[model samples]
Target: MSTPELQWFKSSYSSSNEPGDCVEVATTPTAVHIRDSKTPRTAQLKITPSAWARFLTTLPT
Candidate 1:
């Protein structure tokens, strides 16, 4: 299957001008996608709904 085309965006909390440390994220209907900005050709990590919520909860409010 071909890779899905998505509008990748960096997290608002991210503060990196260099692409090496940049992470790009995109949202899909059933998952949240995360990929290294420097390696777009590599595989992306997909997080489930519940896990995504918990991950956000761990972040500072």
Candidate 2:
């Protein structure tokens, strides 16, 4: 079986000058996927879009 491709994007908050420290994201209608920018081939964390929204709400200012 062949693995499907996903479009990943690094967080805008991540400094552009340093490409090493960032988290990549890929979103679909069903879920939001995340992975370390330093390691793209590894397993990504998959979460529902609602869950992702809730998570972001908890971020400290």
Candidate 3:
């Protein structure tokens, strides 16, 4: 099945000048998508909203 195009964005913590250190994210009602900014066409990770929420809890604020 073909996937629809998603609107991707990077975190504010990611510096535009340091493209190599950036990660991009896209979200839908059912899932969240993550990909390396430097290689967008490469493999991407997809997770459910609940999983994404749990992941956020593990990160330092």
Candidate 4:
């Protein structure tokens, strides 16, 4: 999808030192935008806020 208007934000946990495997996120009124930090200009995977929350909760700390 064309995400020309989404204001993307990188995870605060991301470190410049660890450049690889980083992800960027954008929050819209209806959905969340997720993209690779290494390739910010590429297409993003959009999901609902509830789905995003569920996905995050499944991550191991």
Clashing pairs in 2: none
Across residues 4-56, which tens digit of lDDT does each residue of candidate 1 receive?
A: 78888987767666647788888888888889988987999999877888988
Model 4 residue 61 distance off true place after TM-score fit, in angstroms:
1.8
RMSD for each of the candidates: 2.6, 2.1, 1.7, 3.1
- Candidate 2 runs further than 4 Å off: 1-4
Model 3, 1-61: lDDT tens digits are: 9988899999989886887898899999999999998899999999999999999999998
Q: Write the per-residue lDDT of candidate 4 for residues 34-53, one digit (tens) a residue.
A: 99988888788999999999
Better of 2 and 4 by TM-score: 2
Q: Quote the lDDT for 32 in model 4.
A: 91
Per-residue C-alpha lDDT of model 2 across residues 1-61, encoded as one tens digit per residue: 9757889998778998999898899998899999999998988999999999999999996
The alpha-carbon deviation from the true structure for residue 1 of candidate 4, after best TM-score superposition, in angstroms, is 18
Ranking by lDDT: 3, 2, 4, 1
Question: Lowest-scoring 10 consecutive residues by lDDT in candidate 2?
Answer: 3-12
Q: What number of backbone clashes does candidate 3 have, counting pairs of residues 3 or more apart or in separate chains?
A: 0
Instruction: Report the alpha-carbon TM-score of model 3 versus the true structure.
Output: 0.87
- Give the whole-model CA lDDT for all candidates, comma-separated: 0.83, 0.91, 0.93, 0.86
Candidate 3 residue-wise lDDT at 32:
96
By lDDT, who's the top model here? 3
TM agreement with the true structure for every prediction: 0.71, 0.85, 0.87, 0.79
Cα deviation of 11 in candidate 4 (Å)? 1.3
